[model samples]
Target: RLPVRVDVPVEELTRDDGLFLVGTPRGVLRARNVVLASGSLNCPKRPPASADLPATLRQLDSSAYRNAAELEQGAVLVVGSGQSGGQIAADLALAGRPVFLATSRAGRLVRHYRGSDIFNWMTLSGYLDVPRREIVLPSGKLPPRGLLGATHTISLQSLSAQGVVLLGRFMGIENDSLIFGDNLDEHMRFADESSADVKRFIDDYIRRARLNAPPAEDDPAEMIAPRLPSPPIHSIELATSGIRSVIWCTAFRGDFPY
Candidate 1:
């Protein structure tokens, strides 16, 4: 059995002669082997233009955000369309607050497709177990961020249906207006392509494994249905837009002072 220390805050760590010296509030402790499990989401990132906002506007990052009830009384502008930003914007809109979502090129996946959860197919296909070294992409390119939630598909398209005003990637602050790009069409197309790629992979796996999965039923209405696209907003005047609060959900970084 191993001894566990409770409520002991680690102050410093150093190495000496193949041993680890840990300094804490009580005293210094030594160990032959050490493990560091500090997480990455502790440090939240904000847009570079966040500092230029007026003092009257309230700002909160994803780390400090709790719920829509705590936000100021007015329209809420959520920057970044990642998991946190999407969910928070949906929640706020559902709670009767006008939510404006500034979107980026984060691709999305359906929660369930072909009578199975997408994650189940990912596990069966060994996609989740790939080693980091085997992962490859073009130079200076990164993978798209996936949507967050369980057993339900939520995309910007769905959020737009629920009265969330979707804006393109936030550029910067210009005068009293927030500048945004006009890449809404490209972002939507990227999401659709990503979803199609995943579906194709699943279909190929089913065929190769000779699984007797039934063909997906066709929904004519759904296939022909057209969704109301989110109009691109080039810029938003903060003073005139009635936006009282801003939520920054860009990304997170690791901050280890030690």
Candidate 2:
């Protein structure tokens, strides 16, 4: 086997005399070519607003959260409406713990559609094979992957149905309250439309290719969001609220400083 190094983190990379010099805690390695294989989701990105939270509350990144039982007794606030945030909030609610979920603009995905898994349709419809250059949106960023549960569909509305108090985008901390934006309805609508857009794209592809796919069917899980009696909470007092811990599922970034 080729020489291998385990548990040795690369500290820096430089070029000298047309060769790459890699610095690590073990030693320096000189090579003709180097591939920085660190993954995009390797570094957890904590929200800057978290700094305003009082030090009494425990803060944990999405990666460090194992289960609801490990948390202190009281309500839990989950930030970000992406896959990690949504699922963790659901898990906490199901465990009989009060949950407050701060929503984001992440899209939702229906796991199964038109008598087939969404992943299968994406593969057959060539949606997954699109070049990265062609898929970047007007905002100069790639469209994010839609949020879905491990075995089914999940959405902010669904979480709300499960007794999880839905809140708008987490802004920052005020005097004694956690400030939130008043765009919860907008975010929920965006997630619904995004899922519909994907299903429509798949439908058009099937028709153009003359494939004998089954007729589109409504997914109960996707349609499970019930109408709310009032708008979601815009701000919450952390002290008055029974919240004791917060799980930050605000996503991650792959940053290379060296």
Q: Pick the candidate with the highest TM-score.
A: 2
The TM-score of candidate 1 is 0.86
**Best candidate, lDDT:** 2
- lDDT, model 2: 0.86
What tens digits encode model 2's per-residue C-alpha lDDT throughout 65-111? 99988999999999888889988998999899999888888888888
Clashing pairs in 2: none
Candidate 1 lDDT over residue span 78-196, tens digit each: 98776778788878987999888888877677777677787888788666687755644565334535654444666777777778888888888888998889887777677667767
TM-score, structure 2 vs. true: 0.88
Instruction: Name model 2 segments beyond 4 Å from true.
Output: 129-139, 227-231
Per-model lDDT: 0.77, 0.86
Q: How high is the lDDT of residue 77 in model 2?
A: 91
Which 10 successive residues of model 1 have the least lDDT summed?
A: 218-227
